[model samples]
Target: MVSGQLFNHKLLDVVFENANYGTIIIDNNGKIQYISNKYCEFLEVDREDLIGGYIVDFIENTRLHLVVQTGKSEMGDLQFLRGSFVITNRIPIFDDKEIIGAIGTIIFRDLDDWKKMNSHIKDLLARNNLYTPEVDQANGARYSLHDLIGNSHEMNELKERVKRVAGGDISVLIRGESGTGKEIIAQSIHQLSTRSTKPFVSVNCGSIPEHLIESELFGYEEGAFTGAKKGGKVGKFRSADGGTIFLDEIGDMPLHMQVKLLRVLQEREYEPVGSLQPKKVNVRVIAATNRPLEKMIENREFREDLYYRINAIQLVSPPLRERTEDIPLLIQHFFEKAKARIGKRVNSIHNDVYELFKKYSWPGNIRELENVMDAGVHLSNEEFLDIDALPEYIKRDSENIRRDSEKIQKKTLKELVEETEKEEIERTLKNCKFDKNKAAEALGISNSTIYEKIKKYGITE
Candidate 1:
């Protein structure tokens, strides 16, 4: 028995359908362009009679037109028909920035049968789910807030901030030092937003060459340039329509491209390199950078107007040092990931290794920490990540810090105070050319007291 019944028999023009599963395709106008012969057999209807009919007229409870209009997928939706629940998936077909049509598939004829999935079907679905060719092309969000791995105050605040701003389509500027996981924050925001199913196109503005960025972003026609592709291609902007585009290292974007980007943000439209007509897009812009945009603006290296436009809502990711409490959590997370990836039996991290990790200042932040874990896991000859497995810098820095800390701990409070005072007085005297009066004034002390301290500390300069 067919799930859809012909409601409109009037003829309309149509074209397109995929038949691997009981599939159907409809044009933007909801007119059925193609119906698989298998489905026609299932419906016991003549293919000629259904081809030009409106999908709603031919299919029971169809939402194909809804996807065509919204350009968003409706996957695994339950449709109760003929005393049983059926599962359906409707996906919009996009041509550049516009939705051309929608395709549908009858995933499950009945809900009960779907629950006890056959092994072959389950494997096929699993492989497709891993990365449907469409998904790879979509640049879907890979990480969500749940994968953000942190429990510190700073991390909690950052998570809350991301949650608050993710509901809107406004521009978001993520400011942080390099390797502070700015892109992770960007992905989390996209995944949490209304456009989660849509593409999450990430472009590292700094990585692309200066000469190619414009065409890389706005695209170009086939004959626009000597080295252009045969058919021409949609730019990242067009590919990101109805979704989010994460512009990483945004400060490195050239001034000319910034101008075009500013216009696109203002007008929500852009012209491809050789196209006469401009195409409109509905995309959320999430820009991130480690550079000081204000400084860049002051130096005239960045556009002030564009800065304000993208910085309407700003988020600053705290450096790893600022969230030290989360270091152990991140360590464990990376360690486990490395274990699985490397297929190693490294069972534990030594207490000394943890101490060194906690003591060292992570200049490269979380990225550096992850690298160290990977190296240690690979180098470990035993079941633990010990000092022998760590990089040389880790041990050297840890030892130096330990020695300095021991020396400081051995000093009495009064001796430490005097040592600090002596260093300050000597530096001041040298800067003042050894003039007692000048040194005293600079040190905020009386001349006589300065002289006494200098003498007491045995300063002879």
Candidate 2:
């Protein structure tokens, strides 16, 4: 006989009957003992029709048979008969230690709903030009803050700083080596900020002609200059009025343009090159540069005042050589991305290929790394990548460095004495990570010797 609290038990059944998921219970004879109203609605059947039907008769997939036979719960994918909608979940109920009955539920996922959510997210990322064919491309070139992978303390600190600074309205100056993904970081900040819903305009300051820079930045009126369009083109600043404007290679910007740029930054308004009217725009500016602006200012190349204006919040990005540990993660990420795009079955990379990568100094940083990996994926004949598929430049440079070491090993007395002086300097540079001042102290050699050898070795850093 059933136990006490029959009324309370009925109230619980009423609550389960109203659930969104399709829930069912079957008896020892494989007949439906109890099925929720939601389950019948999913099956598009009346309650009376489903009450005595076999549970297996309705379940589309035979994979559910294991759960019924073994008295153990199991989950798998399934599709409904009417809508053909894809659903996934488990058989939930059991009668005893022996196989007797089961209950199952479904989770319906619509592709249209997923597409809508994905499109909305892409708009939030402020993706302008789609770089779909690039090695790092994922899901049609939508990048999130999480995609910026690096465990280096410097990278982590930079990410934390981006999160904090994204809320404020201050101008940011990102200083880093070229090909180090400065533009990516700029977009990430814009996407994470309150202005995510707004536009994000990226302009390569050095790419545009000096004469056209003014008009490109501030919109000109119709017929402002000779051969001007009938309808004035909107400037990047105006296009990014409520969002952000990324100025790349700002150090190469002409001095006259710098003066005008500084004025606009101070006043938040600018007259278009061809227009008499001044347009006001509320835009957050983020500038990036590979050159040393501080040295430029001292040499009277970059304006000191303009540097101070943009440098309100400075972010220094470390080069790839400084973060050698992140190479493996970058390789794996690019491999998966390439496989998805090219439909290749590449599953692994040679261990020696990674060792070679870590040994060489990447002058072009992450961008170069992506290019190298992409080329390897396309050119590789084997299922996994090997060193033979790498570019000639990388192979030649590494070969030259290794050959130089071998030459030092084989030398006569006079040659050994001559090389000993040079060897001492090279050893110090390696220990100091090529920092001249530290190398001088460690070698007990003069700073001038360190500088002289640096020129001889062709070390730029």
lDDT for each residue of candidate 1 in 112-178, tens digit (9 for 90 to 100):
2332222223223324464222332345776666556789988888877777777667899999999
Among all windows of 10 consecutive residues in model 2, the one with the lowest summed lDDT is: 131-140
Reference-based TM-score, model 1: 0.66
lDDT of 2 by residue, 321-361 (tens): 99888888888888788777887777679897898898889
> Model 1, which residues run further than 4 Å from truth?
1-138, 418-461
lDDT of each: 0.80, 0.72
Off by over 4 Å in 2: 1-142, 401-461
What local lDDT score does residue 196 receive in model 1, on the 0 to 100 scale? 61
Worst 10 residues of 1 by lDDT: 7-16
